[model samples]
Target: MSIVKIVEQALKDGYLTSAMEAEVGRICNAASELSIEEYMALDRLMGALLTGEVVVLPRKQFINVMEELVLAEAIAKVAEIEATSEQNLDVGDIAAYALNRLPPLYATTEEGANFQRARAKEELQEFISKQVKEAIAQSLNKPEFFPERQALGTSSKEEVISQVSNLLQAYAPEFEPQNDQGTSSS
Candidate 1:
């Protein structure tokens, strides 16, 4: 909810675009809000509903929400930097609040640091990385994956227009952009 508030305000105050706000909201909606412990437990939970623990399947929605959460942090970091002065930056407060509320990563060091890097944290990171990599691998096969394949490096107007024209021909054959004549047709 705080993320939603931040994005909405950012757009209203002209600091963020409406499209960017919507994008953040969309990603946030897909994420699951679990403390570190809860998330770890889900991996070991059995029968899709582990005993005494809530086993959450990665739902279609969580992905979007997770994306939003990621974007919100990035946007917040940017805002913190542009805050005009130290008095305007609420970044530290927000970060501290989130970290404080997060479940204490199971076995911590005697010094109270979660830096037992040899522990569950590594496994968790690996699991998450695998999940993301798999998602991208699947997306690569999608027909719309590279809709503007040649748009990656076009610098001049002619080159960019040519790339757009190719994409339009493949994706929107029914409609013709007025710039069709402007192309060299080579």
Candidate 2:
């Protein structure tokens, strides 16, 4: 959605989601310049946020204990391999692979998280280790396909600007820039 649309939605709902905030940030960062409408929308959002008219939701209120366990195991194993050799492993990839194969232990409170962590260590350490090892092996054996692919939460500047421009055109067609011929640029 365009910044105006997102702001309108947030105003209507009285809540600004983390995703919405991130999208706005991404668009603002990507754009070389913001339109007058975009600036007004952002200003309104800021005022609403400051006055408590809109609440920004927290990105995550719970934690998965299994992810921490798998990450710790993966880092230790990857460190061992990297220490003795020149090979470097993607710890995030390894952890994600293992996490997908394991059950989640979610906790909303610190005490709950501690209990979940202890329970996992006592009952699932071996399984977590095995999964991490398998993930490492698979990563090692996997060929380097799509080597140019960007990592998560990233995009080319041109791509981001194009997306923002398209959104602006769709929501407010009159905002499009005109050439000397008095026609909008494509």
Candidate 3:
């Protein structure tokens, strides 16, 4: 079954919420080689993520189910950092260290670094927001799933304004890329 289908079933099974299903859908689209066959693990993992349930899967199966294509160790580290952060470490420190030791996705940009504190939880929010936006954008590709009301969800002026504000806060890129390092196109 497709990840979406699996997620929907899992949601019905009391594993996850509709909102979380929507979020995972984005992550699924972001990945490279992940296929529909292994979504059961994702449904389980996401439930774990949202509820702070510790999950241990067979090594290969864990990697196959994760959305970012994160390796077993990396997933372990994100989980570890998240766990340790409350007592002795911050996510930036962990992520910075991770950047050096791990691959690009965890390290790519420090866009989420400063917000990694337990109280603020910025990095997690950033990750979720990005996934949400990406999922919504990609859903547009399927007319059946991305019906007009569902796709935009902006039938009123106030809703539109709120949506735009929320999107800008969460998903809007910071700069349009420097044309010549000193100058901007805008």
Q: How does candidate 2 score on lDDT?
A: 0.80
Which regions of candidate 1 fall more than 4 Å away from where they truly are? 1-120, 145-186
Any runs in candidate 3 off by more than 4 Å, and if so which?
A: 2-151, 172-186
Model 3 residue pairs with clashes: none
Model 3 scores a C-alpha lDDT of 0.41
Across 1-186, the per-residue lDDT of candidate 1 in tens digits comes to 344443344434534444544554565577667445434433333222334332232322111122222223423443554565443222223333333333334322233222332242344444433443343333333456544544347645466446545644543333322244644333
**Model 2: per-residue lDDT, tens digit, 20-101?**
9999999999999999999999999999999999999987767677866776578678889989999877766787899999
Q: Return the top candidate by lDDT.
A: 2
TM-score of 2: 0.64
Candidate 3 lDDT tens digits, 34-62: 75555656756677557755322222211
Order candidates by lDDT, high to low.
2, 3, 1
TM-score-based ranking, best first? Answer: 2, 3, 1
Q: In model 1, which range of ten residues has the least summed lDDT? A: 61-70
**Candidate 1 Cα RMSD after full superposition onto the native fold (Å):** 25.9
Candidate 2, residue 91: the lDDT equals 69
TM-score of each: 0.18, 0.64, 0.20
